[model samples]
Target chain A: MTLFIQQLFDGLALGGVYCLAAIGLTLIFGVLRIPNLAHGTLYMLGAYVTYFFLVTVGVPYVAAIGLAAVVLAVIGVLLERIVFHPLRNAPHTHHMIAAVGAMFFFQAVAQAIWGADFRRMESPISGSVTILGAQISWQRIVIVVTAVIVLGLLTWFIKRSIHGQTIEAIEQDRTGSSLVGISPSRVSMLTFGLAAALATVAAGLVAPINLLAPTMGDALSLKVFAIIILGGLGSLPGAIVGGFTLALAEVMTSTYVSAAAGEGIAFVVIVLVLAIRPTGLFARAVQR
Target chain B: MLTVRGLSAGYDAVDVLHAVDITARAGELTVVLGANGSGKTTMFRTISGIVRPSAGSIDFDGRQLPDLSADSIVKAGLAHCPEGRHLFAKMPVEKNLMLGGYVRRRNRGRVRELLEHVYELFPILHDKRHQPAGTLSGGQQQMAAIGRSLMSDPSLLILDEPSMGLAPLVTAQVLDAVAQINRDGIGVLLAEQNAQTALRIGHHGFVLAEGRVVLSGTASELLDHPDVREAYLGV
Candidate 1:
């Protein structure tokens, strides 16, 4: 029972992390309709930014996270301006090629700047507390709490704010959005920057536990893609539900079976579930 | 308030609009009548700056419009209510209407006034304000679409095929709303396939065929013309 409770916390914390990271990708996909392969790189960049701020600049963890988010947002704006803007009208194939190229470019740049090292950052709050015979880390709890708050705020923003309303409107009908005076280009720029900033905040929270490496984002992005697909592409609630579901499934596979099974099980479940419910778990139904 | 002189534009190599010339004056409802594929929509697109003119010019209130972006042209007091009644189907009727006021986002007071104005224009929309746009009837959806365009408080509105797919009665209600909007002092450049009804409400009309203006005359002249009667009105 204790082992089960411990693993549940672990799964929940991991799910929270996944939810944060997957949201950036999902929002970019949902609003912009771009398969943002570079999201993974932004995640890696965010982790690195956090590392640089925490270790090199020697700021407090909270301040470091804040600084890293801002830096990543600026980087995101630059990324949109320099790369995505020019290729905005390219064919889908070109978009795919460009994103793959961007991933490698960021990886190479990181390698040159930081070197090929698998580095780890120490959590500000360490050690574990026992409750109901299960040991839980303070950091993990923070992850879960922060995820809920962030997602809740995001939901609120989209529901109540004018800018979020514009995004929602555009997602519904692009031509209609234009008539309402919403500039798709400007919205895209802001969304990319915001998604990048969100990625950095998620990275800042999770990097201490997962550690950091240039190659980290590749597998993480694949996992997030599975999450987005499982949740229903472009659906916010779907992403959250999918993230938790994927994390629990992986954690259960690791606990009951083998670690190897955990890694490959997401793909297996995706293939099976997608085969049955083609449009995803929460696909937007066509209205009359 | 709007002028197009020898405007030629198209998608890539194929020209969809050929040297189109038209003018829409303030306080008048100008109708551009055409069958499907007659470049009426392409003309609207050019006027709203969705597409650039390959030749000639689009002047709105003495400012060049062709080179400006769609949003800029919208900011310059032109609004387009596109065909097919493209409402945000899943969103509330009020949100769909509020999104129309996106350009004037900074002005909450004006937006509130506009909201009240639109609600008054289409009282049904206010009654169904909280419902998702998809749940509205065909007539109500058309009213919401028109109400949305009015939220921007545009000087000249380019309405594209406002009567598409609606029943004759619903079309009449929608056209009546357009005339009411014009009476409120906005210039209306309406495109329609329903020639007789459109001419009845319009001050003047232009006919487009195969991307060229085939006929141009006052409302009564267009209704009485032999070619327009044979080709469009079926009289």
Candidate 2:
């Protein structure tokens, strides 16, 4: 029972990270209709930016995270304008190809700037506590709490705020949005920026628990795609629930079965979800 | 307030709208009558800057409209209520209306006033204001769509096939709302397939066929014209 409780906390911590990752990618897909194959690369770059600010520049941890998010946001905007915007009218394949190209190009830039060595960051909150015979790291607790707050705020913004409804408006009907004075281009830029910022914040929170590498986001990207697919694509609540579901599934599998099966859970999820409910668990009925 | 001369536009290489000349004056409801595929939608798309005119010009209140973006055109006070009644289905009715007022969002008080005015015009929308726009009945959806356009406080409102896909009574209700909106001092450029009804409410009318303006006259004249009577009114 104690081990199970410990694993649950572990799963929740990882779930928080997974939710952040899925939210960023799904939002861009939901609004821009671009799958953003390079999203993981953005995640990796975010961790590196956070590391540079906190360690190299000696900035305070919170300020470092904020700066990193801002930097990633600007990078995201540039990527949208230079790559995605040009391919907006192009075939879907072209957007994927461009994203893959961007991934490779940005990865090379990171390798040159930071080197390919595996690195890790030290968190400000460095301690552990025991509750109900389960030990939990403060950092992990922070991750879970912060993720909940951020997502809650995001939900409010999208649902209640005027600027955020523009995103929802464009997602529902592009032509209608234009007719009513919502600028798709401007919204696209803002979506990309916001998604990137979310990614940075997630990476900053989780990097202390894991090693940082240029390839860190690659596997996570696949996991995030699985999450969004499991949750209805572009559905916010779907992503959140799917994130925790996948994380818990993997954690339980790894503890009870082989670790290899844990790593393969994403593939299992993709296959099962595709076969059973292709539109995902929360997908609205297809519009006529 | 809005003028188009020799405007041509199309998807890819095929032109959908040929050098179409149109004029919609301030304080008048100008109706464009056409059959399916007669380029009424394409013309509206061009006027609203959704499609770039390959030739000629679109001038609105002395400003060249074709040079602006679609959203900019809305900001310039020309609102388009598109043919399909494309309400953001997943969003609430009030959110849809608020998004329409996004351009003038800085004036929170006026937006609230606009919301109240729209509610007064279509009380059903206010009753269903918290409901998803997609869930509304057809007539109520049309009312919401029109209310959304009005939220932008447009000087010239262009409605495309506002009566499409509704029961006769609902169509009359929606058209009646359009007439009410026009009477409130907003210039209206209406496109419709229902000629007799449109002409009855319009100050003047233009008949379009095969991407060209086939006829133009006062509403009563077009209502009496043999060509319009035969082609559109099915008299």
Best by lDDT: 2
Candidate 2 chain A TM is 0.97
lDDT of 1: 0.88
Which regions of candidate 2 are displaced past 4 Å? A284-288
Superposed on the true chain A, the predicted chain A of model 1 yields a TM-score of: 0.96
lDDT of 1 by residue, A137-229 (tens): 999988898889888988888888999877777778888888788998887777888889888888899998987899888888998899988
Q: Against the native chain B, what TM-score does each candidate's chain B reach?
A: 0.97, 0.98
**A169, model 2: CA deviation in Å?**
1.0
TM-score of each prediction? 0.97, 0.98
- TM-score of candidate 2 against the unseen true structure: 0.98
TM-score of chain A of each: 0.96, 0.97
Q: Write the per-residue lDDT of candidate 2 for residues A1-288, one digit (tens) a residue.
A: 989989999899999999998998888988888789999999999999999999999898878989999999999999999999998989989999999999998899889999999997987788899989999899989999999998999999888898888888888899999998889999999899989999898899999989998889899999999999999888888999999999999998898887999999888998999999999998953232
